[model samples]
Target: MSAADADTVLFIPGLWIHSDSWAPWAALYEKAGYTAIVEGWPGQAATPAETRRNPAPLDGVGLEAITEHYARLILQLPAVPVVIGHSFGGVVAQKLLARGLASRAVAVDPGPIKGVTKLPFAQIRSALPVVKSKKNRSTTVALTRKQFRFGFGNALPKSESDALFSRWAIPGPGRPLFEATEAKKTDKSPAQIDTRLADRGPLLIIGGGKDHTVPEVVTRQEFELYDTPAITDYKVFADRGHSLVFDSNWKQIADYTLSWVAAHRVNA
Candidate 1:
């Protein structure tokens, strides 16, 4: 098909990772005859450097705000598009799918939602910087090099991990982390996704074997939660960590996503 007539794919980035990190993925999608829309969260600056210089705009941005922002973006498009997201972005992606706003979705190492009860130690440790205190709920939290290594780059070499941190890391709102970590506690949590929609579009949940933030078990639970008869699939990168989407081997995951979407023949 001509690029002009091809499907659309919207890329969403997680915490501490800049929207620019999706540039390579967007290039790949555009080359594959897809309309690629890559944008930062509601309060994120135009670039990572700009966001780091003044992250005040990102403070107090919560899951509800993030989810609604994407909802509006999708509504403005000609048709519902394929949504791909990692980390907290993944959480919002699933919520979009639940609302029947996406043609298809791929959630990579998505954060814990309302029904998920699995709280692994590493997951707790990875979120401690933001979730440890209520004071952080209304502020933006920066990831230290050390914390980034543990949460996003455990499978990568120290040099590459450091370089990735230097290039893409930015302060992210703490409200989402607080909402995710304390999801089950809320009576009507915004982190909940209705995974039982029988007529919903296809979904593929990817998990990284060494991901500290959202472990393999967490992704597995998320996939299983979809009792719907609609297509729901799960894949794992056995040696990767949470940084799989932007790390050196990002093409592997991107190519896999393209192939999956082609094979399923999901609609726009």
Candidate 2:
């Protein structure tokens, strides 16, 4: 099909990142024959300067709030569109799906939601820098070199990591991490969605084998727990890390997702 006949593609970013940072990927999706839309959370300031000057509440925001924001955005679409999300955005995608929002979805290393039982040690440590400090309850922290080395840099070079830190790194809200960590205790658990939304639509869980934050093992288990008849596909990139979207291998991953949507998503 031509671009004119394709459904729009809405790209949702993970925590600590902005929608503008996704411009390149949006272009790629456009080239693949879809009109692309990149959006941010209500409180997500545009620049680091803005974020520093007016930092928002980290612990105050809840899942329902984020879900509502995306739901509103989804409603503005011409029709139900393919949703692609990463990390915390992945959790948001799950929330959208539970509400029967997306035509299809690609969740890359989605963070655990409530009711998810497996929390890897690496994932915990990657998040400990924020949750460990009481003073950090309302704060956001940039990933340190050491932490990135462990969580996101295992498969990338120091040069690339440094460049990404300079270009893409932003202060992420601590609230979602805290909430997702304590998701098991919450009523809107991952299990609740997994159980209730068994046949909402197709879901593809993409994992990076070298991702320490959402380790491949943890992602695998999360997939198995949640995958139902609606989920029609899955894949793991052996050498990729958590920052798969910007990684050199991202085109292949994006292409795979585009192909999946082409095969499954019905045009309006």
Model 1 spans > 4 angstroms off: 1-6
User: lDDT of each prediction vs. the true structure?
Assistant: 0.89, 0.72
lDDT of 1: 0.89
Largest lDDT belongs to which candidate?
1
Best by TM-score: 1
Candidate 2, residue 104: how far the Cα is off, in Å: 0.5
The digit string of per-residue lDDT tens for model 2 on 240-265 reads 88878866567878888878778776
Among residues 3 or more apart in sequence or in different chains, the pairs in candidate 1 whose N, CA or C atoms overlap within 3 Å are none
What TM-score goes with each of the models?
Answer: 0.96, 0.89
Instruction: Report the error of model 2 at residue 56, Å.
Output: 3.1
